[model samples]
Target: MVLYQIYPRSFADSDGDGAGDLQGVIDRVGYLELLGVDGVWLSPIMRSPGADHGYDVSDPRDVDPLFGDVDTLRHLVEALHAARMVLIMDLVPNHTSVEHPWFDAALAAGPGSPERERYFFRDGLGEDGSQPPNNWPSVFGGPAWTRVTEPDGTPGQWYLHLFAPEQPDLDWSHPDVGDDLDETLRFWLDLGVDGFRIDVAHGLAKPDDLADLPDDVEIAQLVVDQRDARWDRPGVHDVHRRIRAVVDEYPGAATFGEVWVGPVDRFARYLRPDELHFAFHFALTGAPFEAGAVREAIDSTLEASRIAGSAPTWALSNHDVVREVTRYGNGTLGTARARAMLLVELALPGITFLYEGSELGLPSDYSIPHDRLTDPTWERSGHAEMGRDHCRVPIPWEGSRPPYGFSTSDHTWLPMPASWGCLTVEAQIEDPESTLSLYRAAIETRRAWPGPRSASVEWYGAPSGCLAFRRDDGVVCALNTSDRSVPLPRGEVLLSSGPLPSGPLASESPTGGVLPPDTAVWLRPH
Candidate 1:
């Protein structure tokens, strides 16, 4: 299945507030249908303090006022269903905003209170409890523990937050936390949501001891560390099993996880038959635009998922990462590589996730003013990493200038580039060779392929800096990642990301296909 992910805040805005809302998503169902996606997965829209952009949920059961009220979300769900589309909400169960009622209760009922037990509230280390319980640093670059002022108006216990201070990690060991999440899942399922995309899925179950990090260990290393990291613990699988039980009650429901654990075998555990249906294969997301590296990522990702009896989920750009077009290097070369990689990603045998604006080949805005940067990484890293705000800018939809008909007001939550006039949907819909058109053509062709659905990839011998794979259906997808043209596989051309080399050889070649540099083509063996 091809799932289109919409970062709701930057997708579109119905009201002149410069922020995307439920009405904005409702208005775009037609566009999603035109894009030919099987379903739409929305990022967090739950009530939040906006500390980690909605990841820090203040309420799991209600929609944020910034996005819309509960009624508006219901309307959006109905609209999507009416269009034969499914809606998947992002579930952030690992943490909650510091302002969340439970967290607030924990703070008020402090010092050995039961409410404090619901989270990782521990006494500080050292005499008088001044130091943190451990040396673990936050993913955003500061100390993971934050000292809280007690209700008695004195220095008090410290709380753990793996991401931001505002996003306090929940005590999954506490049964109530799991029970509450079950209710949250059923609340949305009853309201007609098809499934959920679990955020930070691997980080739910923390080490029981909460021991200090080793001297040489870094928080960043924890992401790829399969050994005794705070994430991807054995207990996390049990949590997923319980969530899967709730999802199983609703027939046809799905669960996708955002798991970044490494050593493919360990990462695959999240997708065991009783856990998540699939987890995002982020290896490809970080892979540079090189054939060998991408092929290796695809192979390892598929193999691991296969062992776990789960489908692999492929994605390129997302709200957290720099946009693919810009990531490939940035200008003509970047756009071309992005287009080529999209074909490779789609042709792979698995569920694919298309980030919003990827079809338009949007570029991240590196020029976002320093003051406007909201990602905690910027401040946590002491202004070293600009963070992901650049990719979160509102997309251009129509018209000639900034906002480009995306919102009533010229202002947007994140500024759009003036040069985006040419990439608007209105302009690209008519241009057959535009990135949007290529996406439409590829999706239509892929949907029509009379192939057996398989989660396995069959690699074909190919030239250096090139990759060719035969899908289970005998459709050969080839990509040339080099700076020169490459021979096309002997097959009938189905769709090409770009034009083939122009010559008699191109004509005499199988189905007149000769892959140009940084181009990909889907072929049907004749």
Candidate 2:
């Protein structure tokens, strides 16, 4: 399946409120249908306090006013359904916004109360309880545990927040969490959402003891490496099983995770039949633009998925990382490589998630004034890191300048570049050579391509720094990572990321013309 991720705040603003709302998604249903997506995976729109965006769920069963109300969400679901597309809402089960009612009660109830039991409320270390419970650090930065004052207005206990302080980690071992999740799943299912994208899916369960990491182990590496006390705990599988059970009640529903575990095998564990329908394997997402690196990542993840007896998933860009254009090398080369990778990703057998603005070949905006940066990582890291605001900029829809028709207002939650006038949707809609057009053509070709639902691939030998792979059926996708043009495979070129070199036709030459560097082509072998 091909799913498009729409970051709500950056997609399109319906109200002139500087934020995209549920009405925005409703208005854009036709645009998604035109893009040929099977479904829309919306980033969190759940009720939040704008802490960590909507990922810090204030009310899992309701919509955030920043996005819209619950009734508007129903309209979005209905609109997507009318367009023959499913709606997959993002949910944060790992934690909730500190402003959530539960967290408020947890604070008022103080330590050892049932309300406080829902989260990790522990006494600090040292004689005066001044230190944190452990040495764990927040994923954003600084201490993971934040001390909370008692109802009596005195320093009392600390709570764990693996991410920002606005997000307090829930205790999955507590029956309250399980009960709340059950109610949440049913609420959305009843609301007509076809599926869910579980945020930090592998992080719900923490070790009972909350042990400190070894002195040599980096705090940041805990989640990536397996067997860590903080994340990917064995009990996490139980949490998935519970989610799957609830989702199974609704026919045709799916549950996928935003897993970032290392060594594909561990990542595969989250894909067991009774657990998640699919788990994201991010090896390719982080791989450098090189033939060997990409090949190894693909092979390992596929094999791991095969071993786990679940379908594989491929995703290039997401909200958390740098845009592919910037990652690949930026400017012309970056756009070319980004386009090339999209072709390769689509050619693979499995679901492919297209990030918003990726089809238009949008690059990260480096010119955002530092003061306007909203990602918490900036302040959390003490300004040492600028965070992901560069990539999370509002999309250029159809206008000549800032806001780019994304909003009727001149202002956007995040600024859009005036230079993006050339990259607007209206500018590329009719240009055959535009990145938008290439994406349209590629998606159309892929839908019609002959192949089994579960297809296999065989690697083809090629020049150094180039990789070629063919579907068991007959389609071949070859990519050139080298700096120079390499001979194209002898096949009828179906689609290409960039232009191919001119020479003798495939019928005349065994290798045809050279394939441009940092480009990829899809072909039907003779």
Candidate 3:
């Protein structure tokens, strides 16, 4: 099934509050239905302190006022279902905002409080009272531990936060914690959401004994804590099985997990039948724009699915990474290359996630002034020397309107890129050759031909600046990565990203015809 990702704040502002809300999403249900996506995955909309956007949730059952209340969310979900679309909400169970009542109660009750054990808290002070129990650093920068004062006027202990200091990691080992999560899942499932996209799903469990990182490592020490404990723990599968049982009680329900790791083998484990229905393969999205590399990634993912006996999901851009267009487009790549990339991703096996702005062929804008930056990552790690604000920019909807129809108000949470005015949904919808139309066409084509249960794919030529492949359905795809035309053999063109040249294919030829640079062609073999 085709899935669309909506970054709530940047999607559309129905109330013109300068920030998108559930009502705004409900208003755009027709837009998504018309776009031909079967499902939509919204970023977190739960109650939070906005520490890491909505990822740092304070209440699991309530909706964040920034997005809307519970009633508005229910209406949005109903609208999507009425349009024959599924709605998937983000589930951030890894941590909670420090402002959450549970955390506050834990801090106030000291070590003896029953709720205190629900979180990771240390007793006694470090050599310096301000120091943490271990040398772990926060993912956002600084020490992972934040000191909390005790009620008795004593120096309080520090707590561990894998991400920002305000987001403290949950103690999954606690029995009550698991029960709380199970109840949370049921709460949403009863609300009629199709499923949940579990944030950091692999991070539910951690090593019992906290450890320190190597002295020479330059990356944040928090990485060590996460890698060493939370991710891919054997115990995590049990937790998944329990959650799966809960989801199974509801028909047509599913789960997707965000398992970020370099090894595809480890990532695939999260997709076991009893575990997550699917987990994102970030490796393919992170690969360079090389044909061989792309082929290798695709093949590896397919192989991993076979080994794991589970379906996989593919993604190019999300709230977490740089945009696909900005990553691959260098001003010279042209729209042809971008379209080819889309075809590659769509043709791959399993579910596909389309980020909000990718259909418009929008590239990330790196011109955000320092003062305009809202991403916490920008302020921490010095922007990681890899600006992410570009991908997080507000989406452009109306071509001529100021802020590109993202917001009617004078100011937005994040500045809209200047280039958005000319590249918007309203502008492209009317243009037959526009990327917006192409995306709609592509989605329709995929819907029409779901492909064989097991489609065989073969490479027919070298991947030197150009690549050619044949699918099981007698469809041949030829892509030219350079600017020059590439010769092709005789074949009837089925689809093309750009203008097609006049030609007829023979049974066999000594050499193929030339293809225009950055262009792609799908043909039927003679």
Candidate 4:
């Protein structure tokens, strides 16, 4: 499926409240249809206190006023359905906002109560319960355990928060936890949500002992290393199987996990037939701009999905990482490379998730002043990490100045770059040479290509610093990573990420086309 990810607060604002609501998405359904996406994968929109930008859900069954009411969400589903598209809700089963009623009751119920049992509450490790229970650090950069003061005003048990202090990790081992999440799944499924994207799917289950991690583990390794104490435990697969059982109850409804595991076999475990329909394997997301890195990422991801007997997922950038345009080097050069990568990503088999503003080639606004930063990581990390706010800036949809039609308000939730006028969607819509146009053309072409019966890709021999792969259907994708031009494979050019070279496409060579440095092309065998 060609799914588009919309970060609600930053997409578009209909009430002029400086935050995007469900109505904004409804109004933009036409745009999504034109872009050829099969569906939308909306980020968290449930009841929240705005911590972690809705990831800290206070109520999983209701809509947040910050976005809209239940009726608004229903209308959004209707709109997308009318356009022959579906809605995949983001579900956070790992933790809950400290403001949640369960958490409040857990705090007031004191130690050993059933309420406290729903979360990871334990006595401190030191004399008089003075120190934290364990050394596991929060993903945001501090000790994971937070000691709570009892009603009598003495420091009592410590609760674990793998993320921020305001997000308490739920005890998946608790029976009530599974029952509540099952109810949540049904609640949205009944409301017309087609599927779910489980947030932190690898993090829901943990070791029973609550063991201490080694000193060398860093927060970044949480997504990379399967050995990290806080992630990828064997228990998580059982959790997925439980969720899959519920999703299977409703025909046509599917679920995918945000699993951060390693190697093909290890990653494939989460996608066993009894578990998730698919698990987002992030090999491609972390790849660099070079051809070799990109090839390895794709090969590994394909192998993993093949082992799982499921479809693969391709994503270049997402809410948490620096935008691809900026990662490839930020400028005219960066934009060119980003375009090349997108073409390469799109030409591959399987589902593709296009992040918001990617078609307009919006680079992450690293210039967002430190004072305006709002991601919890900024404070939790003691300002050492700037966090993801730079990538979460409001979309520049139209107009030439600030806000760029994202909101009518003078100030948005995050500061948008004034220099983005030229990158606005309105500026790129009709310009055939613009990045938006390239996306439209590419998506349309990809949808039309009748891929091979077997989805596997066959690698074509290519020169140094270049890579070429052919599908069994005779469609070939070539990318040039060297500083010089290279001959394209023997095929008719279907689409290219950039302008082709002048002078007969270097006809003197056996091949019929010249691929410029940092460019990619899709072709049908001649």
TM-score of each: 0.97, 0.97, 0.92, 0.98
**How do the residues 486-525 of candidate 1 rate in per-residue lDDT, one tens digit apiece?**
6677978888888876664575566565778889988888
Error of 1 at 181 (Å): 0.8
Clashes of 4: 0
- Cα error, residue 327 of model 3, in Å, equals 0.4
- Candidate 4: list runs displaced more than 4 Å: 221-226, 503-505
Candidate 1 stretches with Cα past 4 Å from truth are: 504-513
Candidate 4, residues 141-256: lDDT per residue as tens digits? 88899999997798899999999999999999999999999999999999999999999988888898998877777666345565577888888888998999999999999887
What digit string (tens of lDDT, one per residue) describes model 2 on residues 120-193?
99999999999999998888999899999999999999999999999999999899899999999999999999
Off by over 4 Å in 2: 453-455, 503-511
Better of 3 and 4 by TM-score: 4
Q: For candidate 4, which ten residues in a row score worst on lDDT? A: 218-227
**What is the alpha-carbon lDDT for the whole of candidate 4?**
0.89
* Cα lDDT, all candidates: 0.88, 0.87, 0.77, 0.89
Candidates sorted on lDDT, descending: 4, 1, 2, 3
lDDT of 3 by residue, 288-328 (tens): 67776777777777766776777667888898777777678
Clash totals for all models, in order? 0, 0, 12, 0
Angstrom error of the Cα, residue 116, model 4: value is 0.5
Candidate 1 total steric clashes: 0
Lowest-lDDT window of 10 residues in candidate 1? 221-230
